[model samples]
Structure formats: structure tokens, C-alpha cells
Target: MAMTMRKMAVVAVMLVLAMAAQEASAAGGCNAGQLSVCAVAITSGSPPSAECCSNLRAQQGCLCQYAKDPNYGRYISSPYARQTVASCGIPVPKC
Candidate 1:
């Protein structure tokens, strides 16, 4: 009985952790397509639009990976990109 209880407790903890991770990812904003559009706009030197900002806020977690990529990182790391993120009120994530 004690072993069963311990296993259940461990399972409960794992479930909770998994749920939390999902919530965190969901809150980070933007689907892959939206992120791609935002990245393209930034690379083109155009000011991000309201939609772009919305997506940026939504996909904040994914941005770090994009920021680290050779093709995308240049635009992601640009001052303009940082400014856009700041303007949108999304906290710049440390990649």
C-alpha cells in the first residue's frame, strides 16, 4: 500500500509539471507561421505591424530559437527587432 501511494504521488507530480510546461508554452505567443511572417518582416527592415507584435508576444518562447539561428538571428538580434519587442511590451527573453 505504501509503495502504491508513492507511485501515485509521483504520477500526480509529473502530471502537474507537464501541465505547467504546456501553459508556459501556450502563453509565449505565436504559432510557427506567425513567427515566420514576423521574422520575414524584420529581415526586410520594415517596422513590425500590430499583428506582428501580437504574434511576437504570443510566441515569445520560440523567439529565442529564431534569434539563435544563423539565417534569422541577424534580424532577430538587430536593434530594430529589440526595439519592436520592447515597444510591444513583451519581455525580451534571454536565449
Candidate 2:
């Protein structure tokens, strides 16, 4: 039973790693974690900083994807988030 449990754990870890790899590939070079710098601006209606703008611009292609994500959609679609993007000279994605 202990060996069976160990095998199951290994399988579970492998499955998780595989899923993570699939997600990374499907992300099309976009990593939402990079946008963490803009969290404060998005939630507080504060002006985005230079780093935030840079990351936003870099991840422009991924904005729609981010908006569609349940984890990030709320913030990505928020009025404050739009304002923050505009303040940084980035356009809010239609998606």
C-alpha cells in the first residue's frame, strides 16, 4: 500500500508538471506573473510606473488572454485596470 501511494504521488506530480508545461506553451510567450507590478495600479487606480508600463507593453498580446482568465479577469477587466493601462499609454484590450 505504501509503494502504491508513492507511485500515485509520482504520477500526480508528473501530471501536474505536464499540465504546467501545456499551459506555458499555450500562453504564447505571455506570463501573467510579469504583470504583478501593475497590481497596485490596477486595484487602487494609481498611475502605473515605468516598469508596469514596460511589462504591460511587453504583454500586450496577452491582455485578452488575461482578461479571459477567471483568476485575473476581474482585475484585467476592471475600470481601474483600464485607467491604469491608459495612464501607461497602453490600450485596454477589447477582450
Against the unseen true structure, what C-alpha lDDT does each candidate score? 0.60, 0.71
Report the C-alpha lDDT of model 1 over 1-95, residue by residue, as the tens digit.
97686556435434433443454476664234454445434434456778878878876877776667554455567776687787678887777
The runs of at least 3 residues in candidate 1 whose Cα sits more than 4 Å from the true structure, single-residue gaps closed, are 1-32, 36-47
> In model 2, what lDDT does residue 21 have?
38
Steric clashes per prediction? 6, 0
Q: Write the per-residue lDDT of candidate 2 for residues 1-74, one digit (tens) a residue.
A: 97686556435434433443367576568776667677667666778899989988998998887678665566
TM-scores, each model vs. reference:
0.54, 0.71
Residue 85 lDDT in model 2? 85
Point to the candidate with the largest TM-score: 2
lDDT of 1: 0.60
Clashing pairs in 1: 28-58, 28-59, 29-58, 29-59, 30-58, 30-59
